[model samples]
Target: MNIAFRNESLPDKLFTILNGLIITVLFVSVFYPIIYIVSASFSDSQAVVSGEVWLWPVRPTLEGYSAVFNYNQVWVGFKNSVIYTVAGTAINVGMTVLAAYPLSRKDFYGKNTFMILFMFTTMFTGGLIPNYLLVKQLGMLDSVWAMIIPGALTVWNVIIARTYFQMSIPDELLEAAQLDGCNDLQFVWKIVIRLSGPILAVITLYYAAANWNQYFNAMIYLKSQDLYPLQLVLKDILVKNDIDVAMLAGDPADAAKREALKTLLKYSLIVISTVPLLLFYPFVQKYLVKGVMVGSLKG
Candidate 1:
């Protein structure tokens, strides 16, 4: 009925239909797993074990969540993870901005040398033993600083942010600001940062997600269970099957139900760990594509 469709050839119509079908199939492939996980988390443990859950929760119950919350370490791990994500993301974003701003400036000296050094680190790193010894020497072992300080800034993020600044903030704008008595620090704080929302959001999301999911660092550096992040605690449950059977079920003799409860707990923990990032992404979703695109562009 539309003018555009009216002019389309039969082959063009067929291609459009085929493309839509493929996209629909891909969407379902990605989306169905999320639905299944959520459904299984809420479903009765027996229903989950029996594979009764499909699109919706069957005989839905909160037992899995109840069991999760009842574990004191889960709460402690969650609290620690939140602290690490917030503090680490703040440091990461701040350091990235500082590094990127200087590197982005055309007049800055030795930027090429600094960029080469940065890229070199990405390709090669000090081995685990050396890294452990360094942390120990710094007195950061078994401390919260161990989690936040070691990976305070990411080099790849610095490059992305530098490119964003180069593409979006013209050199003429800097000259104009300087003429108006704006100092370098003031220009960065007021102008560059304020105008660089998309890239900032992109890097913030990246750093936040990384800090939240980090576990290997905690495993290596922290001796205290109190310092463990949510992901580490999840690793214990999912990989090692470390959950106590008595905590989930009142009757320890009920082996089948306990096994089912364990499976349900895994699903619940996954949902719990994932929900924060899922909630966080929507707030910055609008910026992600635009930021990645503009930041990728080079002179």
Candidate 2:
């Protein structure tokens, strides 16, 4: 061991200690909350309410899930949420990509002027009432389009994507494509798109998450109970405590079982609502990070 050379110029002993401390602190900060939630979700409701399930579950139960799923409305809400997420995200990504591409190019005429127009919206708005009135006048007040159409072009995403294009995509490639008789559409599809993996991932994640967790638009624009998203349904359940007592257990005769089931379903809602994002995030996380970097820096 004494034969090993020390790179003393790198600064060793104190640096190693500090690095360990920082990493430990970061890890605990992130992991503890997740652990607490998971434990609380499984614990008995009274135990959870009394704060006995702080670090780990006590009197573990699954009633919360039974309470949540037994309701036919919850399933319908889940289906509506899925539909909204899929359709809304598709619209968002398509518009964002199309809009971002041309704006990314320095040679494009009036690009700065166009960028200013977009940025201006981010700083100010026409106010909520006017926007609501416009939506109502346009006959989109009670439709899914109310959610998707209103947010189709996010200025932040557009700017990020444009930045990504400028930084991550080389100008020489565009020139070479043009020399080969490639048109704008072909260049965008064949050349620019192929190099945009990280940015695409980031955009997809943003749209998907936003669409998935959305509720306010549904609440404001939709009057139909069947069209309510999962979040809205969850809010009704939580704020109103409107769970049907009959479906709260396998049999209504047992009060203890029903109480336990209600507790489990409350926790189950948290787990269920979060599951999709958790599953989806890992698939695109690598691309997401790269996309953010690509879009942030100016050429």
Between which residue pairs do clashes occur in model 2? 63-261, 64-264, 64-265, 164-294, 164-295
TM-score, predicted candidate 1 vs. hidden true structure:
0.94
lDDT of 1 by residue, 31-51 (tens): 999999999999999999998
State each model's CA lDDT, in order: 0.91, 0.81
Residue 60, candidate 2: Cα error in Å is 4.6
> lDDT of candidate 1 vs native?
0.91
Which stretches of model 1 miss by more than 4 angstroms?
Answer: 1-8
Could you estimate the TM-score for every candidate? 0.94, 0.86
List the pairs of residues colliding in candidate 1.
Answer: none
Report how far off residue 231 is in candidate 1 (Å): 0.5
Off by over 4 Å in 2: 1-26, 44-54, 58-61, 250-260
lDDT of 2 by residue, 41-69 (tens): 87777787666887988888765666666
